[model samples]
Target: MTDVKPSCLEGIDANGTDSESAVERTGAKPAEMVRFTATPEKNGATVESENASQLDQATLMATRPNGGWKAWLQVACGFSLMFNTYGLINTFGIYQNYYTEQFRFDPSRASLIGGLQSFLLFFANGAAGPLYDAGYTRLLVVTGTILIVFGTMMQSLCTEYWQFILAESLCIGFGGGLTSFLSPTVLSTYFTTLYPLAQGIAASGAGVGGIILPIVYRELEPKIGFPWTVRVIGFILLATLLLPVLFLQPRMIPGAGRKFIDKTAFTDWPFVVFLCGNFIYLLGAFTPFFYVEVYAVQNKIASADLGFYIISTMNAASAIGRILPNFVSSYIGPFNMLLLSSISTFVFAFAFEGAHNVASLIVVSAFYGGVTGLFFALQPVVVIGLCPDPKLIGTRVGIALGFISFAVLASNPIAGAIQSRGGFVGVWLWAGVTTAVGTGVMSVSRLMKTKSNFFMKV
Candidate 1:
């Protein structure tokens, strides 16, 4: 720690006196303590070392797993809490069609609602991080569950486009933002090695929600109406939120919070780069998800039995996508999976955009949904690398996800505008190119953080 000294060997004055005392105390030879001499200008300072092995113990506990029933239970809580907020939003296409048809907005205008929903969901990420640090997990979860449940319940009353946007898009987006922050942070806390796996499993809840809701909505909405369909979904989330409150333990480090940044950390070049990458990724992400059902309808594959079943199919594939890449991510690192996920984005953005009919749209949905899930899965992991302190993980995630919200708010409407101009072709082209650009940004992230390509980490 000093320029003048090499650190360990310090001079002791009359060291033989100390050595003799030590030898007499232990009944050992008189030379048991070593003799040392120091010359002037070659002077050394006295140093002391304590053998308290327990001082840094909490740091290890905070990052590494305690590895038992309690931790896994917390993981399960994370699964329930996360799976709904992140996963259920995948069912967006079904709701998209419903909102558009009901509100009678033009396609470009209708698409903005989807963008707004996406924005609210991610925007919540930024606010909840600081709140979680200040307020703790219990307060956030309680507040989030109430907000989400009330938001969904309110969706039934949406009679116009603005009404739907206000109730479903903005309120639910706020709800999602509150709920999303808890998942990876909870899991990463207790099971660093197993975090990706936990994250994968937890995120699958969204997939499950996506699959179940569309089918349920398609069948039940005609019978009971849109208001009730959303009410049921709210009820389900209410149940999901309970398990975490009853069982999940914090494992929070004593006095650890808000440590990742100085006031200038937001201005730090690395975080700015990650934010840009996330923004672009999110910008390209929602077009396919928001449009798949419409694409199906336009292509003449309508069915009472299966009109919105495409959302379910995509959700199923995405369920696996979330789990698999996460398992792979543990060994290869999060950035590698993220890079591959981004490439998958370009593939689907271009491929699905061209689908003027049923089969092509389905192909696009399945492929795009899978990668979307992968991107969702990896974003949390990638953000964690930017800030190492456990206390600050929530904030880092919030910032990354907040940018994603901004991107989501803009991307779909942009794609919609393009579609309005030249039909689906121009829009899909824009989607493809947007994804390709996002991929480039992520490649830069890999370079700055670890200086490796997606494959080399393997």
Candidate 2:
């Protein structure tokens, strides 16, 4: 029998012990270690034998394709997935408006349709993660693509509330959740050193999609009518989604006998704390995106025509924010970037309420989108860093995002209630306060992980 020391396990815990010990401490069954030591010398394989020194594992990690045609192609695959999923969700407001105007439906009821879609978009992540770990990448992406395309087509024919809910919310949202979570999880396996940068580039697709899709809707609906315009959007998604479905592949082996729940992840204090901080941050993170244009129109700071494009401007700026900060994060560490962005976001939350003019409103929207965009891009990378087992990245991140889905679902209604009672100022104040608390929580998590080493890159 080949003797592999327990001390040389795949992942290191916060206590400086190997992941084997951490797994034992958590009472999880012994999982298969990474095959780095024995795999052939191709792609990411290292020449080190199973009996080689602990450096064997490190060598395997260092062999990742940081930047190459194949690796960059994977990044493109991730971008396509993001564009088809979250990017589509970003344009829901336009559909909500159309539904309310054409059918004279209650605004709150119409909002439910979009809210349900957004909720399931993340909520299905719990199952999505485990499925990915089990080597179901193609299944998830293929099924999700079919659902989204079919749902969009069905949405064109719907005239009733329940029909829209079934076609638009349930089908699209659940499909999006299944596919969206795969992007970061897959990217983590391809480029260890430039993971954050690659992920940022992929995530920028959301901002790009956000900017373009709404424009497509706004310009097309007038010229082609609602049904054909939606069909056109569906065609765009179909063309884009086919790329990821055909090309995106996982670089790592499937986890052998991985569990669905992954309780070991929750046992880690730093990860637990970080997960809580993320949930709290999400509770208010989307308030500005949700209401920036509303604030512009209601306050008469901008005309409806100009206000229509405020979100587009914000999303365009966010594309820059998503890519540039992430490139820097590769050197500074994702955790450090997370803290900086969280603090900046808190400041911007308050600044948003103080904007009393069109120029100021547009500027605040731009800056806020940039800051929050950094947070969005950094989140999955942070989750991957905190996890002890490389195999658990998908499950743990899925759990983290799935937990936060409730916050995204309720964020708008909570802000609306505050608006009714106290107006936009109260809403902004709430956003700032929640974000500040979340930042403080993440700071504590960082301190715990680094053992108070202020200079540490982590």
Candidate 3:
């Protein structure tokens, strides 16, 4: 075949060159040969090609997500993983009440165990992300399942404070963290446009778990006692965990030679500012989650069983909160939705301080659950938006989560101490003030990014 330059193929019809001659010379089909037009500029003629446009369209179609049974299955697995992990974390208030009553432990001591559990759940994500990147998705899931089962089962046998801390705080916390970190990571692989909504649905599993577990514990404890109640929960966890281990998988091959923590993310000012805001937000975020049952009991607002019902109320509302806000965020922007949710949380915290009666407390719990649920559903998507490079998203999220872990760790114990000193008033005040301040900081960061464009989606 003759080596024909692309320039020679142009204007073949106008220049009276036959189609056969052009095909014979260029070795390209008539459909494949793209036509270009030359336009006069100051320097020379600028050529524009239709072929480039077609190539771009082809690339987009090839990369578009296949949203079918497989993709939805990943979302289902994500839901189960969350149900077994953070869903159990959401039951901390119930456990807090149990530990205090059974062991005669002070609120501060009980909170220490809950706080440590929350800490490890988030803190371990920094390490788990890298392990997922290294192709340990299945390994991490299996190990987390074993640990969660073992920890829950062990909690049945523990009578000492230290033993409770070891089983519930360290073992369960570590296991949940490992499984939770991988849930969203694997789900993201099979989605693109519907990602936020899918993630919201998956994360709503926490709310579902939160509702079921507390109710189970509250009703079962009266008949079967604490040890047996916990054993029942352990069995439930086993059933929930098995689904994810069998189905959840990565869409791509495991990444190799990537650093566990990416230090370069710190160079981005928006991400750094967002991280600080998250830290401040979390300082007060978990207070209600850890103390509401105790607060109700201390104030004589309701009976023990009813107090547990309040937690279930919050979790039920949170399920709606998690799903709806995330779907809205897909249209309005993640940061904007976060700001609104954060403000709502702050407002509810203050309202919770004034809630002296059972009716008021129930109302507050519902609204608070609805508002705060957005934080978990929207946070990962917000972090991903701040990253300059898509490949570095996991690392950036890990670092942010690691930083937030310290805040979660300290928030419960600190609130417990404050409650000890000044009662629930002090705890509520702390939650309201810190969350409001965090919202303010996030607003400022948004301003810095948007400048004067108040209506900008960012």
Task: Give all candidates' CA lDDT scores.
Answer: 0.65, 0.81, 0.75
* Local distance difference test, candidate 2: 0.81
> On residues 1-458, what C-alpha lDDT tens digit does candidate 2 reach at each position?
11111111223433555544644564543222223233332232123234333322333232344666767888999999989888899998889889999977798899899899999999999888987876678788889999999999999989999999999999999999999988888877667657888999999999999999999999999998999999999999999999988777765545557798988776889889988888788888898888888889989999888988999998888888889988777667788898999999999999987899999988988999999888998888888787766657778878988898998899888988898899999989989989999999999998888877777776
Ordered by lDDT, highest first, the candidates read 2, 3, 1
| Local accuracy of candidate 1 as per-residue lDDT tens digits, 1-458 | 11110000011112222223444554644222221122111012111112212212123232243356766787778778766676666666667667668766776666666567667878877887765544356666777777777878888777777787787778777777887778776666556556667777777777877777667677788888888877887787788788976665554432335543335547656567877877776675667666556556675665533546776778888888888878767666666777888898788888865666667667777888888788787677667656634446667777777766767777766767676787767767777887788788868866665544334552
Ranking by TM-score: 2, 3, 1
* TM-score for all models, in order of appearance: 0.80, 0.88, 0.83
Best by lDDT: 2
In model 2, the number of clashes is: 0
Query: Which has the better lDDT: candidate 1, or candidate 3?
Result: 3
Q: Which candidate tops TM-score? A: 2
**Model 2: residues with Cα > 4 Å off, grouped in runs:** 1-62
Q: For residues 369-449, could you state the per-residue lDDT of candidate 3 as single tens digits?
A: 988887778777677667544344456667778889999888877886798798889999999999999998888777666
Clashes of each: 3, 0, 0
